[model samples]
Target: MKLKLVLVEPEGMINFGFILRLSKNFEVDELAVVRPKFQVDHEEVLRFAAQGKDYIEKVKVYESYEEALEGTKVCTSAKVSGTDTVRDFVLPWELKEYVGEPEVLSLVFGRESVGLTREELSKCDLLLHIPASKNYPVLNLSHAVAITLYEVWKQYRLERGNLPQKPSEKDLEVFMRVAGELAERFVGDEVKRERILIGVKRLISKASKSELRSLLYLLSRCSSFLKG
Candidate 1:
């Protein structure tokens, strides 16, 4: 399981530096920053990062959240609060259940002030929140990153023992495209087609690499029959 840490528009150099260190400590495969507010190589950032400057030096910068997660199979946005209607929010410890083995698992931490926007959250596959006091649920940027990374690390150690390499984002995309085509061909109603596609995506989202391969095979066989 490869873990990627993404920070969106972080303003404080100290926080950025600390997160750099945390990423290294947690053995993150990649560190990405989206439209950072301060220079990444600022003295303060270096000072806080200490020995983790190597990770900071290789930090990938992106203009948008979507670009940052280009090849990520599973992405979770850190949020302190969300709409009551959105029931998919999961606690940090429960994240492993929502995310099966994937080539790249992205953990997105929002800016220090406003956090992730609803639009950004919608793009993420899941929402993760650290349990805290209601009076002050939001946590510092680096702290949140540390906690989330730690949980994921623990989960990785527990669940990834002897597991096969997971499917990549490209693999999932191919499956979705094939499923969409099948839905369009067999399901006459637009609404029904959309629903079937959504259901397929949800199932694929939780599927492991072998499970996805089996599903793709089944879909391919069915698609061939439909064409014939």
Candidate 2:
């Protein structure tokens, strides 16, 4: 499947450098970052990414995570083992069923200090965790990038299966709008309500358009039911 990789508030420039290399390694089409801690001109990242300088420049920068995930199916990477918020959260290999063939995808990596926040993880349709030794669960940011991308690319080469159907951009927008309306309706207070809306947007980012169409229809029926 066609995919892009995103890094959120990356603290290590060196990791960014190697991740850029990994992007090309996996044939990933885009790289998006959200408010990186270090400047792009910083030597640590730039020097290590000398070979991938051109690719690095092509990396899109966003003021926030939302901006980076706009119009993309965002997937979050986790360090924990067992399933949680998103069921069936598995290693990249198990995700083969979802990948092979072609679809727009975005894999997100969070900073080292505090992995992805609960708020950020809520936005993803799928959560992926690299299987690591229980003794030491944490993985270096760049290493995690290399391992996950490799598994994804390996799966792509082996299966090469087609998807049931791909969703259109228009379908996704309508679904988002419908979801937004539902969230605003459910959460009455304005401040807390906005947070709920953000969660909904994140949850749907990874859904296929066909999946979303079904969801939109369900949401419509729910709206009518509420009225009665």
Candidate 3:
């Protein structure tokens, strides 16, 4: 399970330095930043990084947030996902289950004062929110990173056994399209069609290889019958 930490427009010098140390401590494969607020080698950042200052040199800088998440399963963390009505979110500990066996896991953290924007959160594959007391659930930038990274490290670094392989993106898309077409042909209820589409997507992400192949074959036969 490869890991990458993505900081989106990080501003606080101390928080950035602390997160740098946490990246090293957790053995992150890459530390990417999107348009950082200060110079990567700023004195204040270096001073707080302490032994982890060397990791600064390893940071990959990017102009846009999407560029940093290419070829990886993108997970964005926030105190509260304001757009939850339209978007689904997961807890930090459940991340391993949510992803579809991605080659790299890219964990994105937003700015210090405000978390990820509604648009950013919508684009992510997974919206992660740490469980906290309702009384005051807010957490600091570095603290959120630490908690999320720790949970991820515990899940991936200490694996118990072999894991199932997820279907490729191409196959999943084809399967989903076919399923949607089938729904359109037989199901007239718009609400029911929407429900079926959502379930089909979840199935594609978690089904085993043989299972997915079987489903594709079945769907193909159904489509053929409809044509006949």
- Best by TM-score, which number? 3
Candidate that would win on lDDT: 3
Query: Where does candidate 1 have its weakest 10-residue lDDT segment?
Result: 71-80
Which pairs in model 2 have colliding backbones?
Answer: 123-202
Candidate closer to the true structure by lDDT (higher is better), 1 or 3? 3
By TM-score: ranked, best first: 3, 1, 2
Who is ahead in TM-score, 1 or 3?
A: 3
Single out the weakest 10-residue window by summed lDDT for candidate 2: 157-166
Decreasing lDDT order of the candidates: 3, 1, 2
Model 3 C-alpha RMSD to native: 15.3
Give a tens-digit lDDT track for model 2, residues 15-100. Answer: 88888777766677888888988886567777787677667766888897887884334454555545455433756777667543
**TM-scores of all candidate predictions against the true structure:** 0.64, 0.62, 0.65
**lDDT by residue (tens digit), candidate 1, 88-137:** 57887877787776778888878788887777777777777777876877
lDDT of 2: 0.74
Global lDDT scores for all candidate models: 0.80, 0.74, 0.82
TM-score of structure candidate 1: 0.64
Question: TM-score of model 3 relative to the true fold?
Answer: 0.65
lDDT of 3 by residue, 1-228 (tens): 678898999999899899888888888889999999998888998888889989987799999888988545555554554665434678877877878567888888888778778788766777778878888777888998899889987787855444565678888888888888999999999999999899879867888766888999999999999899
